[model samples]
Target: MKNVEIGALILRVVLGVTFFIHGLVKFQGGIENTVGWFASIGLPGGLAYAVAIVELVGGLALIIGLGSRVISALLAVLMLGATLKVKLAMGFLGNGQGAGYELDVALLAMAVFIIINGSKLLAVDQRFGKRQKSVAESV
Candidate 1:
């Protein structure tokens, strides 16, 4: 496939950083607060931690291109949950619950785009992927 170098890079970096910031917000309220918040919303405490780690670590992974597709896919699902759990009641219109999930939807779409496109040139994923493919083909 022909490489779209700029588009691939843009999707990875932008979505990665944005997802990372969402995780960073968790640190602001502390784990105790996060757990409490989750419990308040009827989610398990452990699940809350998992969500936090996934957003933080997954975003970092995407940034380094270590597991871009996996990370992107999971984050897309996470955003899906964010919408359903919290934003659904708010509807598409802006509300006190928070701004509508237009931004979250955008991020989900961007991550999905990265998944289908692969990490592309200049990505560590591409480098390792090539090596693995050669081994598989030889075998």
Candidate 2:
């Protein structure tokens, strides 16, 4: 693969694994705590479930390279919500009363990069695109 493709693949894998672990941890730790935290941050408690599910599913999608652009967009929005509602006041450091949004911002930036790059190389999207191109050519 080209260096660019390798970079994209690496980024996608890292992001996928990271979010998957985080979602799994949240689930294991009980959504109640997530909900409580959300409520404390002035967000609806029920949103915790949605966020958790999205992260889990989106992370898997990222790993498999399916619908990566869409998933990345969704993750970006999720990170935005987190940054705005929970981490803006804590500054850049995550060592305090509340963790800062630094990681969230980084994740958001990565997601945006994936969205802009559109899942190139080793991605299911590329396979589908190839098939579509061949069919179109035949027609």
Candidate 3:
């Protein structure tokens, strides 16, 4: 694979695992707590469930390179929301009260890159695209 493809794969897998672990942690640590936290932050508590599901499913999709662009787009939105809503006040490096938005911004950039360039190396999406193209040609 080309260097860019390899870079994309690395970013994809890292982002996927990060999101998957975060989602899993939310559930494992009692999603009710997450819901409460969201409500405390002035967001609808029900949104936690949606966020968790999206992170879990989108992470897995990204890791497997299925609908990578779409998944990355969703993840990008999540990162943006997190940075804007939760971490912006904490600042980029934070004030020692809580972690900053640096990580979120990095993740957002990675997701945006994937959305624009796609993750095709060793990806299911690549195979699926090839199959579709072949089928269309046969027709």
Clashes of each: 0, 0, 0
Candidate number with the higher TM-score (1 or 3)? 3
The candidate 1 region of ten consecutive residues with least summed lDDT is: 1-10
- Per-residue lDDT, model 1, residue 30, is 89
What are the TM-scores, per candidate, against the unseen true structure? 0.86, 0.90, 0.97
Runs with alpha carbons beyond 4 Å of true place in candidate 2:
none
Error of 3 at 104 (Å): 0.4
* Per-residue lDDT of model 2, residues 23-133, tens digit only: 888899998999998898788999999889888988998999989889999899999987876678788786578688889988999999999986677888888989999
- What TM-score would you give candidate 3 relative to the actual structure? 0.97
lDDT of 3 by residue, 6-72 (tens): 9999999999999988998889999999999999999999999999998988889889999999999
Stretches of model 1 off by over 4 angstroms after superposition: 1-3, 133-139
> What ranking of all candidate models by TM-score puts the best one first?
3, 2, 1
Q: Whole-model lDDT, candidate 3?
A: 0.93
Estimate the TM-score for candidate 1.
0.86
> How many angstroms is residue 77 displaced in model 2 relative to the true structure, after the best TM-score fit?
0.8
How does each model score on lDDT?
0.83, 0.87, 0.93
Expressed as tens digits, the lDDT of each residue in 1-139 for candidate 1 is 4557678887898888887877878877687788898889998878878988898888888787878888999998998998898877777765865788788788888988988987765678778888999999999
TM-score of 2: 0.90
